[model samples]
Target: MDFLERIKARKSCLKACETTVTTVSGHSYMEKILADGTSVISWPQASTSPGYVIDTKPDLQVAHVLPGLCMGSQDVAHDFGLLKNHSVTHILSLGVKPVTLDQMLNYTYVQLLDLPETNLISSLDQCFIFIDNARQSGGCVFVHCNAGISRSASVVIAYLMRKESMNYQQALMHLKNIRPVIKPNPGFVQQLKDYEKMIFTLDGK
Candidate 1:
């Protein structure tokens, strides 16, 4: 199915995220900081139909209400018309593959990492490598998936837990703040709890 269709079908499943996502190259960049001290950004693509040029400059930030889940365009993500000043190096894709739709044409950031689907165990694995790479690079990490809901949030949550040492609730709050639309599947959430419990058991917590 088309990317737009996928978003329309799952809009209700996403939660309310109040964080600001900047639209630079037509793509959306939802920014957040994880417990690991690694800078986390969610590239939800915002929407399909592109609209007005919001902001441009030394301090550019945007608050958007998304109608769907599919990504915007990479042209918009790399449009530098507004992002010329900032430097993007790390990219984290929660989706099995990047570029869901015919969006990200030629735009390329610096480094890209892909994680498996969202679940307690998979999330932990995804973050182990994701955070390590982010620390090694000292650059920002951009993460996205089909819809940026479950898969992206789960992995990012794990990163928050490990790096920032935030508890599950605390980490989840950060995710919601950034992408008010992020609602991990109930099963996904349970899995994370299980994973957390497992860690506590192993660590004698």
Candidate 2:
């Protein structure tokens, strides 16, 4: 990167690096937010077995899209704790049923809307509402289903496009930084491109 870009990147990195000082023999874990302003979910493991850590940048508000069963109690709790550091105050699950605090911490959101299905259009419409509320409240939000993939990424890109003025490529790259495998399904990716085109047509860009 250019010198100025490097400097700016470093500054953001510093801001996102909120390290946990305390350590527990087994429970303690350290996290540092990515330059995109999302948390890197890490837990140290024993020498015998190593596991992958979630190093995500919740640059913009986030979403999760998965089957109803994926957001179980344990995973919900994990996401809830990471939410604090990522500034994720509002949780939006695209699944039909809401994720209860049996595992994740309780969040007092204005409302949680469960849609009919995981179509691109449905995801976009829900994103509109969350983006509106989040902007008004000045709080971070999240969208998830099971694994943080296709549906999550699609809604996230919509939020970026409508709110952050990110073009398709830039928005996709940003999501990649947060979750490298954030590959929205082929059909969904096409829809996002179409959304970009719709904006371009309106703006004559």
My TM-score estimates for the predictions, one after another, are 0.49, 0.52
Which window of 10 residues has the lowest lDDT sum in candidate 2? Answer: 65-74
lDDT at residue 75 of model 2 (Cα atoms): 41
Estimate, for each residue in 93-202, the C-alpha lDDT of model 2 and write its tens digit.
Answer: 65434556433332322222222233576447655676566546766555564455666667777777766788999888876775676777777777788889987788
On the 0 to 100 scale, the lDDT of residue 43 in model 2 is 67
Q: Which candidate has the top score in TM-score?
A: 2
- True-structure RMSD for candidate 1: 20.8
Best by lDDT: 2
124 in model 1: Cα distance from truth in Å? 3.1
Q: What's each prediction's clash count?
A: 19, 11
lDDT of each: 0.50, 0.56
- What clash count does candidate 2 reach? 11
lDDT of 1 by residue, 1-205 (tens): 7998786666645554446564544556676654333466667746653445643332123112121112212332333442222333334444344442223222222222222333356445644575466546554344454455666567667666665667788878876775676777777677667666766676677
User: What does the lDDT read for residue 179 in candidate 1?
Assistant: 66
